[model samples]
Target: MPVYLSRTANFLLTEEQLKGLLKRYDINGDGRLSKKELQVAFRGLGLNFSGFRARRALQHADADNDGFITDEEMKELITYAAKWGFTVN
Candidate 1:
């Protein structure tokens, strides 16, 4: 049988959580982090997300041609800030 936990059991994320996650991954601190940066973070955190796949995943999300990604774009690509090695709340 499948048991559903209470709402409290589910992790909820706040803006600060998102910001912290971004800051953690933002190695160069250029106000943004690129897919390569995320790849490094994922590797350090023991997560699985290929660099090529990650780039492909972030196709339209990369709003600026500068190559680095912004927080808003990451959120949009992941659909939520918590899934891509980021903490929620």
Candidate 2:
């Protein structure tokens, strides 16, 4: 017999969770995080970084150049952020 947990218990909003997870960086709440948004988030965390430098740092992940980090781009951004030198944490 297949015994499954309740929907609430099994439900894992991966996408929504990703959005909410990065909410701090998604200041506008447009479901995406922009360079400016990232800068703001980092600033809030006491990470001293310049506006121009911030955008450039995120450029590595912004392959499309749309000026925003999409859900697919989030992975790269996260990895890049951890290794990027622009951010002074």
Candidate 3:
């Protein structure tokens, strides 16, 4: 499914653009997202995920199990979010 409500907007983003947008949540610009960063990212998108739910998100998206979401891993997250009706802002 397309990631945004406007089908045309979905066509506007390349995977690289989408990936770069996810990195905006990396407050430290560390090239990865921590649990806390993930929390803010979710909050920014109006998602109420936190606590155990946030941890679960990290686990699902942290493909390397490194406790952080890399740029590549962010794709998994974006796909999952799109499936759940969430879109990157």
What lDDT does each candidate get?
Answer: 0.55, 0.58, 0.68
lDDT by residue (1-89, candidate 1, tens digit) is 12111222444455545445555877777767778876775465455655754565456567765566776666554443244544433
lDDT tens digits, residue span 1-89, model 2: 12112221433334344345456677666888777787776565345554754686568888788888888787666556545332212
Candidate number of the best lDDT: 3
**Considering summed lDDT, which 10 consecutive residues are worst modelled in model 3?**
1-10
Model 2 residue 56 CA deviation in Å:
2.3
In model 1, how large is the Cα lDDT of residue 80? 39
Name the candidate, 2 or 3, with the larger lDDT value. Answer: 3
Candidate 3, residue 31: Cα displacement in angstroms equals 0.3
TM per prediction = 0.56, 0.61, 0.71
- Clash counts for the predictions, in order: 1, 0, 0
Q: What is the C-alpha RMSD of each candidate to the true structure, in Å?
A: 7.0, 10.6, 4.3
lDDT of 3 by residue, 18-83 (tens): 566667989998898899887877666555655554587787888889899887787787766554
Candidate 1 vs 2: which has more lDDT? 2
